[model samples]
Target chain A: MEKRFLAIGWVLSVLLLMGSLSGCGNIEPWVKPYERDRLADPIMALDGDPVSTSYLQHVYEAREGARGGEGAAGGGCGCN
Target chain B: MAAKARPVAAAAATSGRGLTMMLRYGLGLLALLMAFSTARASVLPEDRADVLYHLYTGGGVDIDGPSILVRKQVGKSVSVVGNYYVDMVSSASIDVITTASPYTEERTQWSLGMDYLRGNTTLRVGYTSSEESDYDADTYNFSVSQDMFGGLTTLTLSYALGDDLVRKADDPTFQRDLDKQNYGIGLTQILTKNLIATLNFETGTDEGYLNNPYRSVRYFNPSDTSGRGYSFEGELYPNTRTSNAVGVRARYFLPYRAAIEGEYRFFTDTWDIDSHTASITYIHPWRDYTFTGKFRYHDQTGAHFYSDLFPSAQATNFRGRDKELSELTSYTFRLKASYAFLNESQSWGFLKKGSVTASVDWLFVDYHEFSDLTANALIGEEPLYSLDAAVFQLFFSFWY
Candidate 1:
């Protein structure tokens, strides 16, 4: 099982690297300033509410065996 | 001839005065343009603050708390943030009631952070500290993000280190220490004008005294003249553990100004535990209100050392009876709504850009291979355990 996990990790790493390299050229569309209203909306933010996200993150960390990869790690508890 | 010369002189004087007036008007226009440019250049992002109240109840536990966060931009390229969070927890779970009386405890956590941006790169550093009746922890974190492809893609790298001190509230001499570290990398890309995707990988390590000192393991007894029974002993665990997780998330905007989001995560650990999580969310916007619905599913396999009951003769060096280490599956459903009461660029009194949000979540968990120890002790037969929980949150945010 450990070996299989390692293999999957390697594959994912390679795929990410390849994708990044292949898109080296400027393939992205030009976004005009006036067309950025949607992007600037609060809903487009990765985390719209910082305090709520922090509380939820702490709850999940205390309940589950898995953690991290979502965002910055802060705060600790003695839930167990 | 004299009269003609006088008329020519007057005409020359009139032309000269008109030229002077034009120069004065040009200078005045230039000054106004300079002032407008300066005002535009000096305008910085607004400072924001948030207050949230959270309540949780279920599974013989109740938690309620409030948190506050504030962020301020120091200049065009620097920002600072601070937060304070508190949790008041009361538990009467099976394990707690079986071993000891029900108890209530409080935990407080505070954090401060700074961010710096230059060109297409951003740097962040943060510190956190938390305190409880029997535990204290401190953590430090740093991260860097760089934008590529003219802001179409962003790459991030982050690291965190934590030191924790654990002690028994009743025993002053009992003390233990733990260390934890995590390393992570992430990539976010805009696939199309209406689609965005993100991928993240994280690896973490924990060392020194990873088990809860208060928890105990149960072992079946065979030699007793009395009926078959179980004995409780202090639990033991490995000293070090390493874990890894990979996650992928994507969002697509609909033609009607709505959005759909999906996420999946895979996790593995050195303790031979594996887990998977999948979730979906839909967000809809009205005139001044936005509503969201989300659902999540999670499943996990038991750790190698975890067991409901162990035979005395078959006991190993490491024993674990913690329910979190047991095979389990869970589901979560959530609904949220937010209203932008004040979204105009102009400020009202001392506040600007305000929103109020409220959300509710329901969670259900089922343990597959683990049984209720309390029930087993009473009836001599174990029954499967399940839990139902609910969470509520209300948030208010405003910018200045």
Candidate 2:
């Protein structure tokens, strides 16, 4: 299982590197000021409600064995 | 009709004037340039406050709480944030009923953070502390983010450390300590005018006592002279654990004022547990209101030393009966709606850009290897355990 995980990690790293390189090109045009209204909307934010997301993360962490990659570290609880 | 025609003719005559047209075009260009310049400059966060209420119900456990968070811009390039949270939990689960009596507890948490911005880089640091009757924890975190490619790309790195103290409520002197550390990296890119993507990787390590002090493991007694019997013993677990996770998220906006988002995550740990998660969300905006629907699926493999029952003759140094360590799968569905009640142009007294949001989620979980101890079946013949849970939240936010 460790070997398999290492193989997957390598593959993902390669793919991400390739994508970043390709993205460095000038193939896409810049968005205009008038066209930014939609992007500036609150719904377009990565985390619109920080308080609610924090609660969700806490519940999941207590119930599941896996954690991290979402946000900052938080206080621990004795739910289990 | 005559008045409209006269106005149209006058506009046509004005267009025929070349100098007037040139002056108008030049002024328009200047205004556009000014807008662009202002958009490129760094902007400070507005002073805002959020009040949230949350409720959770499942598997004979109930939790309800309220949280408040406030952010204030201290200066041109500095911001401060503070949070206070509380959780009131009441539990009467099968485990508690069989081993101990039902109980109610209250947990409180406090956090403070600061952010500093300079040029294209931002630095953030935070501290959090939580206290309950039998547990106390403190965590410190720091992160830095840098923007590149003319604000098209962002890279972030973060680290956190936690110190926790766990104690048995009945045994006053019985206390244990644990330490946790985490490291993470993230990258975000604007793939196109209507698409954005992010990739994140995190690794965490835990050392010292990591198991609940009150949990017990069931063992079959073979040497019983009268009949086959069962004995319960305290659970034991390994002292060290390490885990890693990688995730990718993407969002794309449709042409008709709607957006779609997708996320996938892979997780693995030293305990031989592997898991996968996939989720998708759709968001639609109409006037000043936004509505969202989301679905998530998660599946995981059991740890190496987890079991429902163990033979009395076979004793191992590391044994666990926690259902969370067993093979399991879960599905969650969520619906959310938010409305912007006030805008900057129409402020409510001293507050601006007020919004209210409400969300609800339903979750179902099935355990593959763990049995329901509350079942009528004998010993190891108990039925599999499954659970249904619900979560609800309502929040109000305002900026000044």
Which candidate leads in lDDT? 2
For B206-318, candidate 2 gives per-residue lDDT tens digits of: 77677787777777886555343666677788887778789888878788889999998899988888999889999998899999999998899988878878877347778
| Candidate 1 wrongly placed segments (more than 4 Å) | A1-36, A72-80, B1-46, B222-228, B376-380
Model 1 lDDT per residue over B277-335, tens place? 89999988898899999999889998889877888734998988777788899889999
Q: What is model 2's native contact fraction?
A: 0.19
lDDT of 2: 0.71
The alpha-carbon deviation from the true structure for residue B245 of candidate 2, after best TM-score superposition, in angstroms, is: 0.6
Can you give the DockQ of every candidate in the order shown?
0.13, 0.13
TM-score for candidate 2, residues paired by index: 0.82
> Any residue pairs clashing in model 1, and if so which?
none
Tell me each candidate's i-RMS in Å. Answer: 21.1, 17.3
Model 1 chain B: ten consecutive residues of lowest lDDT: B1-10
B192: Cα error in model 2, Å? 0.7
